[model samples]
Target: MVKIYGHPFAAFYWKVLIALHERNVPFEFLMLDADHPQHGEAVARLSPTGQFPVLIDADHVVIESAAIIEYLDLHHGHAPPMVPADPRAAIEARQMDGIFDDYVMAPLSRMVFNALRDTDKQDPHTITVAQGTLDKSYA
Candidate 1:
């Protein structure tokens, strides 16, 4: 089975997990503490950036969430792909996905973990800037 090495609550990890889950792919979620010794080895072996959401499929290693998600969509064509097949539709979908990753994903993610830690108070300026970027997502 494919094994994903990552922290459970991490946004990038969750993104890859969600992509696999949405594709109905079978995978083992190996939760890793950032400070763990094996975590460094796990990351160094796969991730160029020493980051989480590193996927181990047998002996092959895959890093970066967008690449992981695209691989899932390509390999598991049984499920409807996130992007439309048409050239324009695929281009637009990719653009929107980028905007979501840039805007909604971060601040909205802060809302999730910060609520648990009681840290990272919401910044109105950040929200306004995010909203402006989101508006461009639809353009």
Candidate 2:
């Protein structure tokens, strides 16, 4: 069985989960807190970057959501038929994924974390910047 070390609230983690689910790949989702001793050591052993959403197979370990999703698509033949048989479409999909990571996920994650810890600690300027990005992203 494959295992995925993930946190449900994590953007990248959920992205990987969605990919796996879309591919109908059977995997165990191991909910992990990056700071926890058990998860930290295991994640480090699996991922050189020590990141979440590490996919562990019986013999091979892979980190990074994009890599994992690509692997699943290659092995499972499970992606939607319209998901780009063309090389350019594949590139577009990857590019859109990167846009989400850089623009949407990153800022939203920071804002959420800051809000969780202390709303006052969140800079108003940063929120304004993120909101502008958000608006642009949706539009």
Candidate 3:
């Protein structure tokens, strides 16, 4: 069975979980929190950036949500691929993915991370910029 190392709160990680559910793929969700030291260690060892949502399948270790999703679609033999099979449709899908990541999620992630920081430690300027980006993206 495939194992995914991630925290439930992570936005990027949620995409992988959604994909797995959509395809009816069975995977173990390895929670990476204070309680799961071993899972955290495994993720730190496998992921290049020590990031969450690392997918381990047999001997293969896949990092990055997009790559992991693509790997699943290709290797898991699911009913319908998350990405379209058609050339033009695939390109458009990929483009939309890039746009969402860069314009929407990037700033949103920045804001979320900033919110997690201590009240005084958080950078107001950064939050302002992120909010501005989000506003533009939404518009």
Candidate 4:
């Protein structure tokens, strides 16, 4: 069984979770919160950057949502490949995925993270810039 390490509310985690569900792949979700028993140690052991949405399959550990999805597509056979089989189509699909992740999710993630910082340390200008980027991407 595959083990997924992440917080439920994390967007990247949801992205990988959705992919796993789409493939009907059964996995154990290891919710990592500050309060969780294995939050500090286990998560750090699995992911070097301390990021969520790490996938563990036996002795193999996969980090990053995009990489996890690709690993799943390669290792687990399911209906409708996450990335198309054709080289050109696959390249386009991956490119679009990168655009969505970078242009859309990246700004949103920065804003959310900034919001979580101490009020005195928060940068309104940064948040505004991120919002503008998001708006432009949406347009």
Assess each prediction's global lDDT (C-alpha) against the native.
Answer: 0.74, 0.79, 0.87, 0.87
lDDT by residue for model 3 (87-128), tens: 899899789778777888889889888999999889989889
Assess the local accuracy of residue 104 in candidate 2 as a C-alpha lDDT between 0 and 100.
91
Listed in order, each prediction's TM-score against the native is 0.69, 0.83, 0.94, 0.93
Candidate 3 lowest-lDDT run of ten: 76-85
Over 86-131, each residue of candidate 1 has an lDDT whose tens digit, in order, gives 8899899788777667776765665554456634664656556656
Considering every candidate listed, which one attains the maximal TM-score?
3
Better of 2 and 3 by TM-score: 3
RMSD values, in order shown: 4.2, 2.6, 1.2, 1.3
- Residue range 1-139, candidate 4, lDDT tens digits: 9989888778899999888999999998887876777755787887888877888899998998999998999897476879888999999989988988998888999999899999999999989999999999899
User: Residue-wise lDDT of candidate 2 within 1-139, one digit each (tens)?
Assistant: 7888888789899888887777777888787864657876898787888877898878888888878877667665456732356898988998998888888988897678767876567677777888888889878
Question: What 10-residue stretch in candidate 2 is worst by lDDT?
Answer: 75-84
Q: How many pairs collide in each candidate, listed in order? A: 0, 0, 0, 0
- How many angstroms is residue 81 displaced in model 1 relative to the true structure, after the best TM-score fit? 1.5
Superposed by TM-score, candidate 2 places the C-alpha of residue 6 at a distance from the truth, in angstroms, of: 0.4
Q: After superposition, how far is residue 100 of candidate 4 from its true place, in Å?
A: 1.5
Off by over 4 Å in 2: 34-36, 77-83
